[model samples]
Structure formats: structure tokens, C-alpha cells
Target: MSLFSAAVAGFGTGLSLIAAIGAQNAFVLRQGIQRRHVGAVVAVCVLSDAALILAGTAGMGALVETAPWALTAARIGGAVFLAAYAALALRRSLRPAALTVDASAAGPGGRSAGRGPLAAAVLTCLALTWLNPHVYLDTVVLLGSVAATHGDGGRWRFAAGAVAASVVWFVAIGYGARVLRGLFARPVAWRVLDAVVAAVMLALAASLVAGIPG
Candidate 1:
């Protein structure tokens, strides 16, 4: 196949994996709506995906696919993290604080006017990216395998296409979600959103547990 065709195929494949409503997308939406270091978060996501895609393109995906134990460990760690975040969301739902709600509010943890909050936000972004086993499974193994079908030069183009998809997705979710800022402006709406987040997190955790090594 031609490089252009391969790139298009890769782009479509990447979107098929990421466009779904999953943990990573949810966190990015929340951060975007909260208007907290959105650019940095988006950058982290795009760059992380790029690295993972490149690794896959370079054939790391095959090596990873051969190791089920590593994915099992990641599943356990990710489930624990998601459960903790779910509890936090539950707490937020039950005890609705006086949210700033305006265009300008503190971080989700409610800290402002310091580097601490920004640093914390960055850490959360990294955790969300690295801890999830699905990211590796989809981007690294699955996408990498797909790219290999395109041959060497075609595979690189395919990887570029996949990276482009990541850029588009993160930019859109990290910025487009701001459109819902007014809807989430009320404490009631915030509570509802947190409840939804909690549910999603729990569901993801359950799935992770189900996938654990028996």
C-alpha cells in the first residue's frame, strides 16, 4: 500500500481505539472543563501516546504481547488507582463543596496560586496515561501489529497517522469540553458529574479485575 493510504488507515485505527469513552478521555474532559493546566495535560497525553505508538511501530508491541505477567501487574495497579479515584468522586458527589464554577476555579482538589496544584495535575495526567493496561494493549500491541502489515516505510507512515489521531483527539477533548463549562457551572451539575465519574471509574475497575490472571 502507498504511504498515504497507510497513514489514513492508521489514523482510522487509532481513532477507533481512543475515541471511545474510557478512563483517559474522562480525565481529560474533567481537567479541560475545570480549566486546570489543560495544555500541559493535553501535551502529556499526546506525547505519551506518541511514544507508545512509536514503541509499537518499532516492534516493542510483540515483546509486550509475549508477557502476560506485566499486563497483569498493570491491571492490578490500575484497578487500585481507579478505585481510589472512584472513592474520591463518591466523596465529592456526597459532599458538594462551594465550587467556584466560574471560568476561573482552583484545581479539582481546590488549590490555586501555586505550583503545587499544577504539579499535582501533571502527575495525575501521567498516572492516568501510564497505569492503564488497555493503553498498551490497544496502542502498543494492537496498533503495532496493524502497522506491521503495511511494511517498513508504510508502517512509519501509519505510525505518523496514528500519532496525528492522538493529537487531534487530545486537542479536541482538552479544549472542546470547555464548551460545557456553563452546564457544569452549578454545584448540582458538578455533583451529578462526579457521580457519573464515580460510576465509570468503578465499572472500569471491575473490568480490570475481571481481566486479572486467574
Candidate 2:
């Protein structure tokens, strides 16, 4: 296939994988709606994905497949984090009055009132991105192997396309969430969002614990 065809294939694949409703996307949506460190959060996600995509394109996916222990460790850690985050979401859902688009609603940490909201957002975004084992499966193992199908030059084009998809998807969600601020201004809206977040997080955690590929 030509380089352009390879790029298009990679772009489509990357978008499909990243567009899934998971912990990372959910967190980004929340941050976007709240208008809390939106740029930072999006940056962390896109950059992390780029790094992983590069690694996968470089053939690190094969190495990852050889190490069952690494995936097991990631699954355990991701499950724990997701579960804890779900609890937080559940708590927020129960307290509708506390739910607001204002940054002061939860403070910078997102859990409680403290300093360094940027730091908290960055850390949470990183965890949600890196801790998930599926990320490795998609960006590293899957995307890498697929890229290899193209010729040597075509593979680099494919990787570029994949990286571009990540950039586009993240920027759109992170920035586009602002359009929903009017709706989210209502406390009930926050309750619903948090409830949904809770469900998604718990489901993902359960899947991870169950050793599911998705």
C-alpha cells in the first residue's frame, strides 16, 4: 500500500481505539466541562499516547507481549486506581449540591480543597492514561503490529497518522467540552455526569480485575 493509504488506515485505527468510553476519556470530559486545567489535562493525555505510539511503532509491543507479569501488574494497579476513582465519583454523585462547574467545587486536587490543582489534574490524567493495560494493548501491541504491516517507510507514515489522531481527538474533547458548560452549570447535570463516571470507572475496574482485553 502507498504511504497515504497506510496513514489513513493508522488514523482510523487510532481514532477508533482512543474514542472508546474509558477512564481516560471520562476524566478528560469532566475536566473539560469543569474548565479545570483543560489544556494541561489534554496535553498530558496526547503526549502520553504519542510516547506509547512511538514505542509501539518501534517494536516495543513485542517486548510487552513477552512479559505477562508486566500486564498483570498494570491490571492490578489500574483496577485499584479505577475503583478508588469510582468511589470518589459516587461520593460526588450523592452530593448534588456540591457539584458545580466552578473549580472551587472540589478544589485543585479534585478530591478535596487543596493547592496545586494543576498538579492534581496532571497526576490524575497520567494515572488514567498510563495505568490502564488496555492502552498498552491498543497503542503498543495492536497499533505497532498493524504499522509493521506497511513497508518500512509506510510504517512511519502510519505512526504519524496515529499520533495525529490522538492529537485531534484529545484537543476536540478537551476544548469542545466547554460548549456543554451551560448544561453542566446545573447541579443535577453534575450528578448525572458523576454517576455516569462512577459507572464507567467501576465497569472498567471490574473488566481489568477479570482480565478482560477491553
Candidate 3:
């Protein structure tokens, strides 16, 4: 296949993989709604996926595929991280907020009080992306398999296309949701969203612990 064709194929695969509602997407959407450090969140997600795609193109996917220990470690770490994140989300959902007597005084409170620290948001994104074995299978193994069909030069083009898709999608989801930021500003809305996020994290953690394939 030509490099252009390989890149187009990779882009399609990336969109198909990332369009699903998974742990990572849920986290990003939640952070976006809460008006957190959205740029940092998008950057971490895109860069992490790019790294994995490059690794897969470079043949690192084969090494990971052969390493059961690596997969096991990732599963355990992901479970722990998701569980902790669920707890944090639940806590945020339940926390009391200072009530404002004047309607004008009310603004984005709750999780939207202030943008989270950039470094912390980036670390959180990294943990969510890297700790999950599913990420490897999706970005590395599956995508790599597709790239491999195109031969050496085409593989790099494929990886670049995949990386581009990730960057575009994350930026859209992370910032585009700002259009509805007002709707999510309500405490009840925040609680509902956080609860949903907590459920997703817990479910993902349970699935990992059960050795269910991503």
C-alpha cells in the first residue's frame, strides 16, 4: 500500500477504536465537564496514544504480545488506578458546597471550582492511558497488525495517521464539550456525571480483575 493509503487506513482504525465509550473517554469527558485542565488532559491522551502507535509500528507490540507478565502487571495497575479514581469521583460527588444567597453569586462550583493543576491532570491521564492493557491491544497490537500488512515504509505513515486521529479526537472531545459547560455547572449535574464516571471506572476495574479481554 502507498503511504497515503496506509495513513488513511490508520486514521480509520484509530477513529473506530477511540469512538467507543471506554474508561479513558469517560475520564476525559468528565474532566472536560468539570472544567479541569482540558489542554493537559488532551495532550496526555494524544501523546500517550502516539507513543504506543509508534512502538507498535517499531515492532514493540510483538514484545508486549509475548510478555504475559507485562500484561498482568498492567491489568493490576489499571485496576488499582481505576478503583482509586472511582473513590475520588464518588467523594467529589458527595462533597458539600457553600451555598450562595444571591443568584448572581452562583457560578461554576463543585468540580468546576478551579481547573486542576496541569501536572496532576497530565499524570492522571498518563495513568489512565498507560495502566490499561486494553490501550496496548487497541493502539499497539490491533493497529500494528494493520500497519504491518503495508510493509516497512508504510508502517511509519500508518502510525503518523493514527497519531493524528488521536490528537484531533481528543482535542474535540476535551474542548468542544465546553459548549455545554453551563448545563454541567449545576451541582446535581456534577453529581450525576461523577456517579456515572465512578460506575464506569468500577466496571472497568472489575473486568480487568476478571481477566476479561479488553
Candidate 4:
């Protein structure tokens, strides 16, 4: 296939994989709604995906395809990360909404106050992108498998297209969702949002642990 064809194929594949309601997407949406380091969150998500897509294109994905041990380790690490993230989300959900603060007071004295929003966002993005076996299966194994059909030169083109799609989708989701922050200003809305995030995270973690195929 030509480079154009490869790019189109890669774009479609990337969209299909990322359109799902995964933990990473959930975290991005939640952070956007909470108006907490949204730019940082979006950047991490897009950049991480781009990096992975690049690796997959570079034929690094074949290494993962050859290693069962790598897959197993990824599964274990992903499960732990998801479980911990779920617990944190649940705690935040259960906390009284009155404790939430405006973005201005979102510092140390703020409700969800922490010194590591950027770090946390990066770590979370990494866990969701790298540790998760599904990410590898979809972006690396599956995408790489398909790209291989287009010949060696086409693979890089495909990967580039996929990375581009990730950048567009993640940036839109992370920043665009911020427009709804006002609607969630009420404490009840905050609680409801957190509750939904908690449920999504927990359910995703359980599904991952259950070895559900992506």
C-alpha cells in the first residue's frame, strides 16, 4: 500500500482503539471537568500515545509480540495501577463535596490539594498507556501487525498517522471538556461526577483483572 493508504489505515485504527471508555480516557475527562491541570493531563496522554505509536512503528512491537513474559508483567503492573487508581477515585467520590474548592484555591489548601498534579497526571498516563496490556495489543501488536502488511516503508507512515490522531483526539477531549466545568460547580454535581469516575475506574480495573480481552 502507498503511504497515504497506510496513514489512513493507521488513523482509523487509532481512533477505533482510543474511542473506547478506558481508564485513561476517564481520568482525562475527570480532570477536565474538575478543571485541574487539564493541559498537563492532555499533554501527557497525547505525548505518551505518540511515543508508543512511534515505538510500534519502529518495529519494537515485534519484541513485545515475541515475549509472553513481557505481557504477563504488563498485566500485573496494569492491574496494580488500576486498582490503586480506583481506590483513590473512590475515596475522592466519597468525600464530602463541600471539601472541593475553586481552581484558585486548588493549591495545598484546596480540596483535592496535592503537590503532584503534573506528576500524578504523568504517572497515571504512563500506567494507563504503558502498563496496560491492551494498549500494547492494540497499538503495538495489532497496529504493527497490520502495518506490516503494507511493507516496511509504509509502517512508519502508518505510525505517524496514528500518532497524529492521538494528538488530535486527546487534546480535544481534555481541553474541550473543560467547557463543561461550570456545570459541575455545584457540590452535588461534583459528587455525582466523582461517583461516576469511581465506578468507571473500579469497573475497568475489575475487567482488566478478569482478563477480559480488549
**Per-residue C-alpha lDDT of model 3 across residues 1-214, encoded as one tens digit per residue:** 6789989988988888987777789878866665577778888888889889998888888888899788888999999999999998887778536211122343345433453467887788888889988998888988888888889889888888889899889888888877767776576777777788889899999989999454
Expressed as tens digits, the lDDT of each residue in 1-214 for candidate 1 is: 8999999999999988989887788889888887778899999999999999999999999999899999999999999999998898888787755343554445456754223367887898898789999999999999999999999899999999999999999999999988998898788887888889899999999999999979
Name the better of 1 and 2 by lDDT.
2
Q: Show where candidate 2 strays beyond 4 Å.
A: 104-116, 212-214
Specify the poorest-scoring 10-residue window by lDDT in model 4.
107-116
Query: Which sections of candidate 3 miss by over 4 Å?
Result: 96-112, 212-214
Each candidate's lDDT (Cα)? Answer: 0.88, 0.90, 0.80, 0.75
Candidate number of the best lDDT: 2
TM-score of decoy 4: 0.86
**Candidate 4, residue 10: how far the Cα is off, in Å:** 1.2
lDDT of 1 at 160: 97
Error of 3 at 36 (Å): 2.3
Instruction: Report the C-alpha displacement of residue 22, candidate 3, in angstroms.
Output: 2.2
Between prediction 3 and prediction 4, which has the larger lDDT?
A: 3
Task: Tell me the TM-score of model 1.
Answer: 0.93
Give, for candidate 3, the lowest lDDT window spanning 10 residues. Answer: 98-107
For TM-score, candidate 2 versus 4, the one ahead is 2
